[model samples]
Target chain A: MIGVELRLMLRRRRVWLCWVLLCAIPALVAVLLAVTNLAPAPGQGGAFLSAVTSDGQLFPAAALALVLPVFLPITVALVSGDAVAGEASTGMLRYLLVRPVGRLRLLTAKLVSVGAFVLLAVVFVTITSYIVGVLLFGFGADAAVGGAGGITSLSGVVLTPLQLAGRTAATVGYLALCMLAIGAIGLFFSTLTDSPLAAALGVLAFVVVSAILLPLDAAAGIRFYLPTTHWLAWIDLFRDPILWRAVREGVFVQLGYIVVAFGAAWANFATKDVTS
Target chain B: MAGQRFSRRWLLVAAGAAAIVGVSAVQLPAAALDVDAEALRRCIRAEVPPYVGYAEASGRLGLPEIPQLESVTTLLTTTTRIRSYVAGADRWRADQLTGALGDSERDTYHLGAAEYVWDFGGNQLTRVLGQAPLRLPRAGDLLPPDLARRMLGLAPGDPVTAIPARRIAGRDAAGIRLVPTDPDTTVGRVDIWADPTTALPLRVEIAARTGPTLLVSELLEVTDGPPDPAVLRPVVPPGAGAVTASAADLSGALRDLRAPPAPARLAGRARLTLPSTPGSDLPGVGVYGTGLAGFVLIPTGRDVADRAVDGATAAGGTAIPVPFGRAARIGTPLLSVAVRSTGRRGSLLIGTVAADVLQQALLELPARGRPS
Candidate 1:
């Protein structure tokens, strides 16, 4: 089942290449940012550096901004949306179901592969962008935190740039689960649709709506229930004492979405008669 | 299809989200700036000690048996003045201050006797100490933040007044009263000290909201006032006391001076930069003052250093002149001392020099209306 899923995905290399190409912008931004430290020509160097340094507080926000566009549910939808449709359009689903193998396993293997793709895309974006940012803007030995509670500061506890990177990496990783949850929804959409366009657009609509509704005052009590709000939970790292409650709650929310979507998809796929 | 249902729900969600953010943005509270600024100003006023002017001396008015001289008078004055400190001087008690401090003490600062005038008649000797005429307190002396820390949470409109008491010149002399007011607060009464002879108040005092309480113990004020305008103009009279000394000896004798190299007067001569500007160098020096008769800007440098002038002219009534280096207009309560001319970096400003020293210079002024 896994081999068959792999072969089918490989056949659609053009669309996958397009997905990687779509990731090029944030990757390039991360690279350039790492190299130049964002310092401009000598005359403007001071001003440019000041501007960049001012963004110290904006670190988590920027990470989310880069990941939200494509590495998220959208990618999830694109890959998963193509799953059943691509197979059916190629006239292969009927041949596969004719085997003794359960239809659910075949779809599960496909779901796992797409889930790996979503995880790798998110992890790469976070690492590459951070490395590029640190390289481009000399991460002064420390970062300054201010506002509400007044000025508090923290930074690299030591020679371990890796350790510091690891801590920051954890924050991005927490955000990644939101992307996977979006992917799960996409996977569910993929199993039900015969057209890849319909599945991908369905996932896209949910993401756009979540982003818009999260900060709305009307939904304040329940807005945090959304995936996009948890995407921002990464910002908790910048707060004093690092409020991980939101991050933790976000994990549960994403997991809940994934279990429900997967459970519902399995049940649907197990009973559906695709023989026609 | 799941896609169809999800798309519809997502569309409704997106619209709701935009509205949530917009309302939250408007609801955030803003800080009040004006109140903070006023509080800061009050802090500066209360924290920075008021600049003071003072002079101390010992002498007899007429020939006494044990005295080697017919009469002796040790006179001292300063421009490190709290406005009411001058009034404090006129009051009876010699030690006191009352009034608003200048607004610039954000850092450490000291007010010194920058000028002095001395004279003697029996020895037929007279010397002039004519400095280049400069005395601006060093920069870091008045940092606002430090002053604010020292004077935070002071009572509003804190003001003080100083007045004279019965004691005069360390002993019991009479003839002045002084009053001090704290512009920072209006709660307390003006301090008063009096002298019967001149009927002038000798000392004034008040409390800073931050430093002193409304209670009486911490009150501070200037002990003397209404300085003879010539006090800071740098000059000494010919036939008054009995003495002779070099500018160096004078500098030593006037060791308590708040200003150094004291503005040249009856002692000797040297150059002085009054913290006027970065590259200010005044070549010629003198103390110009107006008295009961008229205003005279006497050249008191080495060559024409024979005579000295008081900031005040005493006829039946004394005309007091104030110094302002920015302009050369002289009148009562520091009319204005003009800058002679600009030089290397800037010019010499007469009034810009602290006037409490001029108050000491007054004793050296020829009784009044004497030949230059």
Candidate 2:
């Protein structure tokens, strides 16, 4: 059942379009920077943006920062929101349910497919950004001489190319987990209505409200539980000692969201009346 | 069958609600523990523990920005978040976290005799060579333990009494209040809370006699053990720009400008000799008094002084009469500054003393080219 869901997702034109648009943004940014030779002053632009001009190897991290704020979440919401509601709107859900597939198994398959899309999107962005970064920035000055030149951590400690690769891989994994939590919430919304747009809008509103409340002092009491509060925790992975405090909290928060949202989705779908 | 399914759905909702309540319940205040106030005070002064912690400090003094003092003004009027790892008095590292989301960081590592400063935003590492007798303030100075210890050391004669204990950073902390009896001092009271067992200060609050609280620094989370040694050692990255700088360079700039010498006595207070250290005996700078009531006198160029006075006046400073020139005074709840211009040179007097004290000191400053 999960294989069928994956195959269907792979063949969709909408899914392919999302991947292309996501990959195009970082490539466009690299062209602009290479042509103009102007990088924002240090600490002025996105996280690793200023450093990207000096060593393009850092562009993957900058690319993630550029998209994490809005682009990535929006795509996740759209794909996951349409998981069940899209099938229901086209009158495919009733026929599938009549087949001997249990509601729980069907919901599980839909969730697995959403999770796959998230991983695919994150991996594609990381790989494409790396190619664009090195082609424009090169391996920096020391790499040419076979010296110790590599990516510099936020703490001013040098990271070898291998270590930089490990950290970048870790960043991709952390972000994939964050997006999975959002997908779980979107799946829950997908079970609420037959309209895919309504389900997607519901998930987006949840994210927007969380983002708005995260910065308010009065909302501090509830900030810890907000899913959006720890979105930037992956930045800590690039630190020299790798400050794990925020990253650990972020992992726990995202896990909690996944468990609760998935549980709610299962409960609602099992008893949900599908008259259509 | 349908009824059983409905119960299952309700069960999931109940479990989610329970999880949130349980998390919030863990953060509720713990009951305070009884402790001897005097014993805790003595323990804090005598026993220093090695620990690692995260702290937050905020000041509401609203100090105006001035040239060459922008850092000082910001430290006194804004919030600072610091992560500190301490093994001893000389071996420690403080990382000041900034930016809207606390993503940017500047770290200072103090080894036995060497100091290194790393800027994450600029990707630069600086090794400080020497110490400056009079240095500007930094984020590390606002750490709860450091700030509490310094304030206690400065006013040793002040009376100390017990205040109600409170919970801080998940610890049952005992509190002490220090009230300065000196009429000339502007500080009203200082409240410090510490762990009774280790006497490590967890929180410090300072306020003026007649105004609102001025500064509050507290440890948000802490652990009671020395951090890994490798964490305190800063390695300069290969591609990072590394440079060596002298601490005295800032003060040396002032001395090269050749301002007038400071008076030996101002407002009946004799000039206090600074501790004799390398590069500290800069001529023409005077430190007055020996306690929290004391102030420093620096002779500066007329333009710098004028700019400071104008900044202060625009921030609600008041004009004051002085010998042979003009003077203006500005004050927060706990700090006072007076700038006086005499001929082509001027003097700046600043301290945690009363505004009138600065006014009297400014009146006694001699005109340039005149004998004291």
Candidate 3:
């Protein structure tokens, strides 16, 4: 059932378009940097952007930072928000339920499909941006002279290509977990309404509210549980000794969201009426 | 079937509610610890065991920004979050987490006598060489343990009393209060809480005489054990920009400047010779008095003194008439700074004393090119 759901999601042109657009942004950014021969000053613009000019190998991290704040979460919300509500709006949910598919199984399949979309989106962006970064800037001139072909960690420690790849993989996994939490919220909202756009907007509104409160000193009391609070914790993975405090907190928070949101989604969808 | 589904849904909601309650229950205050104030103070002064923790220091002194001293002013006024690892006095690391989004961080690694500063934003590694006789404050100075120890050291003769023990960072921390009797000091009292067992300070709060608490540093979470040795040693990455800088570089006002000798006594307080690596004394610098009631006299370039006087005056500093060129005094609840500009050079008098005390000290300062 999960495979069928994944295949069906892959068949959607909207999913492909989202991936292409996500990949295209980093490519355009790389081209502009290459042409202008300028990068944002350190401590400005995106996180790893300033370093990317010297070392193209670091561009994947720069690209992740570029899209993580808004673009990536939007696509995840769109896709996950449409998971169940799109079927109902198309008048397909009732028919699917009539074919002896249990509500639990159907919800599980939808969640897995959403999860796959998030992982694919992140992976595609990383891979495509790496290619674009290397094609435009090449494997840093310093790597040739120093004979240390690796990227510099945020703590000024040299991380070999192998270490860089490992850290990048870790970053992908961490980001996927974060996105899945958002997807779970989207699913919960999808179960609430039959209109796909309404569900999508609901998820977006939830995220927008969290993002707004995440930085306010007044909201510090409740900031810990905010969905967007730990989204940037993945950046800690690049620190030399790998400061695990935030990352550890982030994992717990993300897991809490996944469990609660998924549970809430299950609770609502299980007893939900299928009038559409 | 419908009833069973409804019960399961309620069960899920109940579970979520229980989880939140469980988390909050862990944070409930622990029982007060019974310990003597003097013992706790002694233990705090003694060598602490190796440990790791996350600390946050916040201040509301509302210090005005001075040219070339913006970073020092920011450290004294805003909230600073730090991840600190201490293996010994000389081996430790403090990573000052910066940026609202936690996107950038600066790490100071003190391995033995050497210090390396790593800036995550610029990806630059700097090796700080030599100890400056006088330097501006940095974020590391605000860590709970460091700040608590320094405060304790500065007020040895102050009366120490036991305050009620409180739970901090999930540990029952025995508390001590130091009340300064020196009238020259603006500090009203200082409160510190430390782990009853290890004596590692978990929180420190400093309050001025006439206002609310001006500074507070607390360890939000801590673990008592040696941190990984690798974390203390900074490895400069190849291709990353690396530079060596002297500690004097931190205080741009004190580099390559000379001044007239300071008076033996300022405002009726005897001048104190600052402890430094013998030959590294910056000559005209003088520290007057001792304990929590004293001020430092630093020679400054004329331009810097003029700019500082302008900045302080603009920030509500009062102009005080002096025999020299000009003088201005800015007083916060906990700190007072007086800038005196003589003919070709100037000197700054700053301390935790009152505005009048700084004014008197500025008056006693010798003029440029004159033997006191």
Please report the candidate that would top lDDT against the real structure.
3
Per-residue lDDT over A198-276 for candidate 1, one digit per residue giving the tens place of the 0 to 100 score? 9889889988888788646567566756777666555445332243555676787777666666655665565565742
Cα-based lDDT at residue A164, candidate 2:
85
Q: Model 2 misses residue A95 by how many Å?
A: 3.2
lDDT of 2 by residue, B1-372 (tens): 997987878697678857855774575564666777677777887766899998879888877776567667777887787889999889999988755545567999999888989986777788987776666678999998888888888888787898887788888888999898877788899999998889999999999998778899999889998999988988766567788887666453245336556688887789876665765555567788767788888777778778888888899999886656677999887999998877887778888887788888888777762437
Shift of residue B93 alpha carbon in model 1, Å: 51
Q: Give residue B128's lDDT in candidate 2 (0 to 100).
A: 86
Please list the residue runs of candidate 1 whose C-alpha ends up more than 4 Å from where it truly belongs after superposition. Answer: A3-19, A30-64, A69-71, A142-162, A238-240, B1-372
Q: Summarize candidate 2's per-residue lDDT along A36-141 as a digit string, tens digits.
A: 9998876577777877887888889889888887888899999999999999999998998999999989989998999999899989999999899999887765
Ranking by DockQ: 3, 2, 1
Model 2 clash pairs are none
What lDDT does candidate 1 reach at residue A266?
63
Going through the candidates in order, their DockQ values are 0.01, 0.41, 0.44
lDDT of 1 at B44: 36
What would you estimate as the lDDT of candidate 3? 0.83
Candidates 1 and 3 compared: the better one by lDDT is: 3
